[model samples]
Target: MAWQTYDPTIEDAYRKQLIVDDRMCFVEVIDTAGQEEYATLRDQWVREGQGFILVYSIASRATFERLEVFRQAMLKVKRQKPVFMLVGNKRDKQYEREVSTAEGAAKAREFNCQFLETSAKTSENVEHLFKTLVRLLRATKQQEQGVQGPIRSPEKEKKGRKCIIM
Candidate 1:
């Protein structure tokens, strides 16, 4: 489940079309600069234990940098609920690339998240990106369920903590 800006004028209509065609669900559209609003949406999804993929243009260094701050906020708010992947979109723009593939991959690795270069324009690996996220989420859910027997509750798990921040 990936969420992008909800602008019906931009990609929203196309996203809705994809939903109608049974391509996706749980789509989120956000303002490009609305970090607060985006944070709220992300927190909500995280609380529901939903995973997400964050997309950025490899041609835009600023967007790439913003991903780090977003990741930090997610860690601060949701703690450990939702997992994420960092995607380098518009990979077909190799001739005009501003960020190298290795750099993108390194950033993802630093954040302990999956990384992939894709070109939505060319429809290159777009399907695979979403499919991989779904598969990983399912597998993670299964693993969590398998390990849920006789685990300590959140309260009990935090008993020894000297300081609690939420």
Candidate 2:
């Protein structure tokens, strides 16, 4: 489903193939929309999820405040620091915004994740949001596989010839 036209129910699942960083990435998106009735089901999905996007509407302060609940649940279920992206949605509703961008950034800092404000309606920053999350997920996967950037010996460092595998 296209981002702009997607109308999520209590839970909706979508699969899309994206060419992120020149690599084919199969992305499965499970959107719960933070409905309280689906908390148990959301936990199950959380356990199986490799990365998470905790989203709140900039127009709704209540939604923004509830982000911690979602974050804590992800941490509790994942049992490790989870890869996350904090998103303030409905950027097209700037006039109705109750949560400031600074608040979103601060909350992302608290969660130790990347922050972005996007408008699904206008397609503002929507692509960047997903792309950034994919990049972060890719980095996290590389780290887990013990592929941490370029390894340079002292001699190589002095020679200024470091090999980086992108």
Candidate 3:
């Protein structure tokens, strides 16, 4: 959901809650436009923002170019790889489009992050962008368990669903 506020936020804040994944997803919605003075604040959020949605305006090529710098900074501060989604917003302004969908997709590929086009004014693909990131994080966490399912007695093991015999 989009929010408008007269109350200024200095640190690029976050609001999180439990979602369908049954996980408390800590997502950072970044806006680098007026953040030139918030470098220290950005670093703090980067350390805590386990997942990120790197948003750029399709209407502005400058925003698109700056996206990579923000992403690299996030990776450096976290000292590890992170879950990220690259979003090209303002798809409704087709006439003003400065960045092509293919360009966004290609940049996402370079960073190995998911990408989608969205229109905040029209609410297109916006929810999908957020949902995809949640699932990606949940799936990554589940991978550690796939290699070792819970052990069960051989006598109770089903034929096709072979149990991990202890």
Candidate 4:
């Protein structure tokens, strides 16, 4: 899995370029002020079976608060399909942090998602964050299939009982 940052200036264009792969994709953007647009995008991603990483700046309490609202908006689209990770960005600015690492981890736990601190500027834990997310997503997908079950391709199952367990 490779990491790629998303441009904040162009909204729709950047989002349209996002692709879901076996790798983690890092998207960098400022917090959204309203829920309407985000909700629509969340729904579209959910329909496409793409996972997401909700990032908040540890230096800003306002951004942290907005993350709660973002989580709520995502729930409106349903929670089971698209997995999520709560990332506390700008971790290198520990002195200026308004939100503690423990607080962010607690919130992520409460929401049943993974949490991590990363700094893009210094590249501190930047690689670790995305790698962890990709690992978690793969593990979650495997767990969803159960211990013993036939693995069936969606396309092939339409014709008959063509199931293959891995």
Candidate 5:
């Protein structure tokens, strides 16, 4: 489960399947941490993602500052704002916390996303974050379908990440 690497330039893409509420949820995780040079690749990933988990370490001030910038990039690239959640990781490292919980909540409010604090090392709220994402994705799909059956444009499906949730 620990796919993190020390190199900032290196990006990893991993897809995992889980059974959520008796249904399969295929989640594709693209770690763009320190991969700003791979903007094109990141853009493609965002385009294809049904939902996203934007993670930042509570101990890193720079990462928190860059969160909005990342959100703006996603908004600019995608026509519709995709379902996304803001996750403040490294919650176990309370001693090194640079970003306060109040600040994280405020920023998440500004970005209009579900916010959760987690400790990847301790597995705190990790499952909850993914479950929340899956729920958001399902809700979004329902809303789209309600608008006269999934407002999809096949033309936009040229090249995008595909999540196979069954």
Candidate 6:
């Protein structure tokens, strides 16, 4: 929000505590911007991540086109269909938009994930995006638990991991 223009991020980490659906969630965000330099390490990040957010600027078709590359990488590393949320950013720049909302929604449908457009400048849907993702993560976790038959004790609880975005 403080940047005057798009800054090419190498990697940035953020920690936030959010209350979603009456449950407290501690979310850690790792923003890599999908730079080529970090391609070698992407697999590790994907393996440690529980949820994913794929973001692209609506004003840049090039950015949108690269979403598949990232999506493929995630699928390959996870070896299963992982949770995903597709975000078309820079909604504030409608005049400069190169990607339409329909295209974004279509892409989300193809990926079988939720989709939304957001303007970081105005803070639109920013919180909603994360809250929705957390809901998805929680639901997935609960489903897995139901399949496992019973909830384990705290002493047997598995370690936690971060929620990553690219």
Tell me how many clashing residue pairs each candidate has.
5, 0, 0, 0, 1, 0
lDDT of 3 by residue, 90-113 (tens): 898999999999999999999898
Off by over 4 Å in 4: 1-39, 79-81, 147-166
Q: Rank the candidates by lDDT, best first.
A: 6, 2, 5, 3, 4, 1
Q: Which stretches of candidate 3 lie over 4 Å from their true place?
A: 1-18, 21-34, 144-166
Best by TM-score: 6
- Judging by TM-score, tell me the better candidate of 2 and 3: 2
lDDT of 5 by residue, 1-166 (tens): 3334333336666677666777766677677774668898778777766777778899999989988788878878878768878999999999999999999999889888889999867778877777778888878877887987746666654343245221
Give the per-residue lDDT digits (tens) of candidate 6, residues 1-166.
2322344456877787778878776788778878878777778878878789999999999999999999998899986568999999999999999999999999999999999998867777888988899989878878988989656665555444334544
Displacement of residue 130 (Cα, Å) in model 1 is 0.8
What TM-score does each of the candidates earn? 0.66, 0.83, 0.72, 0.67, 0.83, 0.87
Per-candidate Cα lDDT values, in order, are: 0.61, 0.77, 0.68, 0.62, 0.75, 0.82
The predicted structure with the larger lDDT, 2 or 4, is 2
Off by over 4 Å in 2: 1-4, 147-166
What overall lDDT, based on C-alpha atoms, would model 4 receive against the true structure?
Answer: 0.62
Measured by lDDT, the strongest candidate is: 6
Q: In candidate 1, list every pair of residues with a backbone clash.
A: 3-28, 4-29, 5-29, 5-30, 6-29
lDDT of 6 at 45: 79
Model 5 global lDDT (CA atoms, 0 to 1): 0.75
For candidate 4, the TM-score is 0.67
